[model samples]
Target: MNRYQVATAELASSQKSGAGVPAYLRWVNRGLGRRAAAVAYVAGLSPNAVTLISGMLSVGGMVVLVFLPMSALSAVAAMVLFLAGYALDSADGQLARLTNRGSIAGEWLDHVVDSLRLPLVHLAIALCLWRAGLPDWSVVVALLFLVLSSSWFFAQTLAGKLSAKAADDGSAAEGTPDWVSFAKIPYDVGTLYVVVAALAYPPLFLVLYTGLFVVTAAVAAASLRRKYRALLAEQRDYAPEN
Candidate 1:
């Protein structure tokens, strides 16, 4: 459709806000992403285009992590690419909401890309560390980190779906304060910023990544366990009486 038609379509679902976003990413998603979404809308670009671009950036960043020197400059370049990719990731969804043009297929593709990237990125980092002559232990730690990270992401997705299914009004949970957002930064997907920064110094990167992996594994495990129990209790409480 033309720009005017796109603008009109956008107005149909034009709230353009995100829920439960961390403060660190709030600026990227709400600020930069929104600006990009506006331009995309005017340019008549579909959300799918934005999604594909995001995927490309992410894939390129992973490639760099795997193949390039683990130098500061390389880390910076890869980090910039990742940041742009993530911003576009947010923008695609925003654009979809704005234009009321979201589709199940689009959402599925977005999540699929995300699921692919999360573990692969870590594995790439591990490979980079090994190439940098880091200890074998670090490589093992990185592999373990990949498994935990992917499991955590999948668990959170499942929890979100279950929560949505259980909510009677179909409304999202209430938003938390900015401090809570800050507290969550370590666990956020955008924590890759921290990852890339750490990579610039391989020794520090190993420690930071290992620490994050341990902490994240604990947090994800607890959250998933609690959510699972709650879901079980709900099912039992609502089970049909004989």
Candidate 2:
């Protein structure tokens, strides 16, 4: 098979095996991903196009966050837009599957957009908290988790970018990898917690911090552990014979 097929197979296999996604996450991902797949097939949008749509939906969610309280209505709107963004996130891959339009460039765009959303959203949340004169600790903790999560994402993205570059240049790639060997951790944990957060507190904003931070920490730990073992395996030289 060609590189495109090879890459796609790797991803699809990783997904099917739940190699790096938390088991509990499968509950939401199964449904959202399937729905995204359906929309992608019907809409004929490319993965990059889907990524752009996801970013736009997220910004729209941010707009709502700024204008409204963390009330039931606002929570619902934010949840809708957030899910829309996530649907787009899932759709990108599904579109690639349907149209055979997947590419390193498409993957690159998806990761870039996904990475940006967390920081920007956290900044928006912090701003809202400041505006409402809530205790500084919540926003501070959220931002801290956001930073940790962002750093982990950058590491993963850089790994992918390097892998793409290496494939372009015909060499080995660098940077931390996309998964922790066999341990699955869902990259979309923020959206995963949205419903739970909304349900758990009087205001949706209240639960966002603990939920995101704890999950981020778990994913990061899993990621680092995987990278360590993968490195060891990679370093062991395999001498081929005739």
Model 2 lDDT tens row, 98-170: 5678898988788789888877776666666666667788778657866886887776655444343211211
- C-alpha lDDT score of every prediction, in listed order: 0.75, 0.62
TM per model? Answer: 0.84, 0.69
Residue 58, model 2: Cα distance from true site in angstroms:
1.3
Candidate 2 Cα lDDT to native: 0.62
Off by over 4 Å in 2: 1-15, 23-25, 159-208, 218-222, 225-242
Q: Model 1 over residues 73-120: C-alpha lDDT tens digits?
A: 889888888887888888888889887899999998889888887788
